[model samples]
Target: MASLETRVTEFQENLARNSVNEIKEQIKEMQKMEESQNFVLKDCHEKTQNMLKRIVELEKTDFDDKFNHITRRMIGEVVREHLTPIQMNFNLENKSIKKLVEEHAYTIEQ
Candidate 1:
């Protein structure tokens, strides 16, 4: 009877080990799920940023087309508000409102 009791105790210990292994596996699965979700969120953020960049470029082109009608002050305000996020590099080659108007007037004459 004592031997039978000892065998039962050993059996319970083995069952406990299996249960612990299952718990560990579950924990690992949860970790993987969290990692996958993080990757998805990162991808979504990248896509959103790309889309916004393209939209800004399109808006800038449209604004450029109508730049002659907008006053210099209004143009400056628009540029400051819209392009402040990514910023821009300005140099002599980058034309201002007055320069662009002069160039357009020259084109019309020629």
Candidate 2:
């Protein structure tokens, strides 16, 4: 009958309208996620560049290569106790932990 055909057409039209709206909503959500990821990546990149610049500035300073290696004897409070007697300040960016121990070792030898 004519009434049955009319109802079926109306139902199909409603389904099509809802499907379009659902697709639009999904696209909007995906765009927001991409924007957030881009912002985080840019922030991390800037922080890394700043750290590299600081490292380059530090390498220009004088560093002692001797006695910076840490042995079993250098563990714990003994390391701090020896470093306290020196007037020198440690610039960790300029040297490794081993190099720092070498500097302290040379100081002890003297």
Find the candidate with the highest TM-score and give its number. Answer: 2
Candidate 1 backbone collisions, by pair: none
- Per-model clash counts, in order, read 0, 7
Q: What TM-scores do the predictions have?
A: 0.47, 0.48
Instruction: Give the CA lDDT, 0 to 100, for residue 30 in model 1.
Output: 100
In lDDT terms, how accurate is model 2? Answer: 0.79
RMSD of each: 18.6, 19.6
Candidate 1 Cα outliers beyond 4 Å, as residue runs: 63-110
* Winner by lDDT: 1
Q: What residue pairs clash in candidate 2, if any at all? A: 66-102, 67-101, 67-102, 68-98, 68-99, 68-101, 68-102
Can you write out model 2's per-residue Cα lDDT over 30-60, one digit (the tens) per residue? 9999999999999999999999998997786
Cα deviation in Å at residue 32, candidate 1?
A: 2.4
Tens digit of lDDT per residue, candidate 1, span 2-87? Answer: 69989999999999999999999999999999999999999999999999999998877867656765777798888888876545
